[model samples]
Target: MAVPAPSAPAATASFTNAGPAGFWQRAAAWSLDAALVAPFAGWLAWPWIAAPAQAWLDQVRALLQHTGQTMGAAIIDGASLPRLAITLLHDPALHQATAAIRSATWAMVWPALLACALLGAIYHVAGECSPWQASPGKRLLGLHAADRRGRRLGTGRALARYSAGALSWATLNLGHLMATAAPEHLALHDRCSDTRVRAARTGLPRWARAWLVLLAIAGLVASAWLAQAAGTVMQAALERALFWPG
Candidate 1:
């Protein structure tokens, strides 16, 4: 049988024409992506495996503490600040938190890796748009993908745009959260991906229809800041919880 060509994604944008994606739009897109991938990944691997993961991290933290004591001892013996700082790098107590972080992080490796791979596949294969033409989340928001000028981004531009997320996400996903707020509505990833997201002109509710577009933009900035803060909080919490291990 002849292979059927791929079709445009079936869109789920209930509020198309609601205007440009607000922070909520981007947020919804990501939520959709999580919805798409989380069920299988979490159901199959998370709950049952969490205990082992936590236990392993705990042991790693203890080892880090032991190592910290050894380093502290060495520093006292040498009476050297310079050596202490350098040697303290190996300090076990100091690293208990770090090791716990490392261990906890390891636990998420599988799921995060799978999510990233799946996200990439979903994005790259989308329509004739560039790899960055439309993120999987954007498509689900009933948003259309285009460059600022409303042109379809070609292959080369798309790859760069897609690659930008590696950077955008580096700052705790501020890259993505910041995009919806840009006057141009271009995220760091969007510039790299050769794509922009606009509200689809369909079935727009009146309230959303007349809402000031800039409000969405401001919301995006606020939300991105909040999201970044949340990441910092989680990291600190992980450090404290895992501190005893070292």
Candidate 2:
């Protein structure tokens, strides 16, 4: 007996949103990802930041080492106080300086992290559409980042994804490269946010996929060169969200 063929699902009458991101879709997204996300990560992780933290640690250590000398001495303005009071609060000047420096360092650290999160979210959210983000690479390649339902992501969802993304990036210095190959064009962030990057066109020709792959390679080369010239460069979230192989 011949089996009856299953009925095909009817296309939505209204204009429906795009769908899950494909491998090439992600590749297209990567074009801009290189320029934005990569560098921001570098700024905070830069050696300059580490130096300040290290200096502050030394300052604390010195305060502890000198405390024994002034066990319980008190000071009167510029005059020396009892040894006990001095020990109680030795090197107040250095301590204050150290505190100020530490505070400044932290000021940069937390904000830099948040800013990275913000920028990453913006890229994923903004660049899922055509003419996305206006980056040369994205324009040339015709790629964008979209949510699973083929709708553009919202700021709230994007932010949530960004936060999760930070963890993934922290672990791997960017979101997992495994996502694209896993199934959809979504890294950990997109998965958590229920978003994805997908191809705009269906059944794309092999040539287009090849172009995407080449573009991805070129983008990587350029980004690496830029990172080398500077200190470091974090891949742009949009590009990573789109083109990065998962």
Candidate 3:
């Protein structure tokens, strides 16, 4: 009789929890990741957004030219050009045009979305394959992502895990909430990818975690401030084009 080769190990029906992280800890880790990733994603999207911004500025110029032509017609008709121009400055058309240009700028959302995905891949995929088996946020929160057997995931598996994470987001976070419902406390992505985020045997010191949290908050504040400044500049430029058209 020929000797038979051993069969592959059978898959388990349910994973042991092993002190898996609950929803709140995972949410906190995700929040920290968002804060850390936003600036980098914004930087990556700047070049793509610049084109849309410029197009919007051009549209503003075109609208202003149209308004100027209307004012010129009123002057030629001897229709009290100064009064007509003053009224045109507050015309509903100008307000609508401004809104449309802003909408055009907002249309660069696709590139920004791609930048966000890439940043998440760099943070989660690469980090999970590393010796720590966790991203910075996860590490700070004392969580380690690993395969069912508690082994660090290879790069391919890590990428799969990252891609699955999109489903969690796309489903309005119901997939994420699965972690709270699942017996193993695994998110949809984790369950599908055969991974789990268990409490690490050891984590960063308390002082280090505190500093990281502070930095994340600071980054969020800085990003918000920069966005406000950019919006102000754009609004001012639009106003000049509308009222002081060349």
Model 3, 1-246: lDDT tens digits are 997754322121122333677776777677777779988998989899888877877776656555655565555556785778677778887778878787876876777888999988988888788777778887778777889887778999999999999899899999998988745788889977998888743234566457668877988999999777655655555555556655
lDDT of 2 by residue, 1-246 (tens): 997754322221111444444555454445347556868865755655666667655554444433422222222223355644554555676477567657766854765566565665565545433234222444344444445555445556655655676666776734666465644546766667676554445444566577667777988999998655332212232233334423
Look at candidate 3 and give me any clashing residue pairs. Answer: none
Model 1, 1-246: lDDT tens digits are 997754433232332333555555655655556556666666556665577577765665455444445544554466577776776676556666666666666765666566555556455535426333455655645565566565656656555665666788788878877765746566667766666767664333444333435456768999998767655554554454455323
The predictions' CA RMSDs to the true structure, in order, are: 10.6, 17.2, 9.9
Residue 10 CA error for candidate 3 (Å)?
28
| Candidate 3 lDDT trough over 10 residues, lowest sum | 8-17
Q: What TM-score would candidate 2 get against the native?
A: 0.40
In terms of lDDT, the poorest run of 10 residues in model 2 is: 68-77
Two-way lDDT contest, 2 vs 3, winner: 3
Q: Which residue segments of model 1 deviate by more than 4 Å? A: 1-20, 40-101, 107-111, 127-140, 154-156, 180-182, 201-246
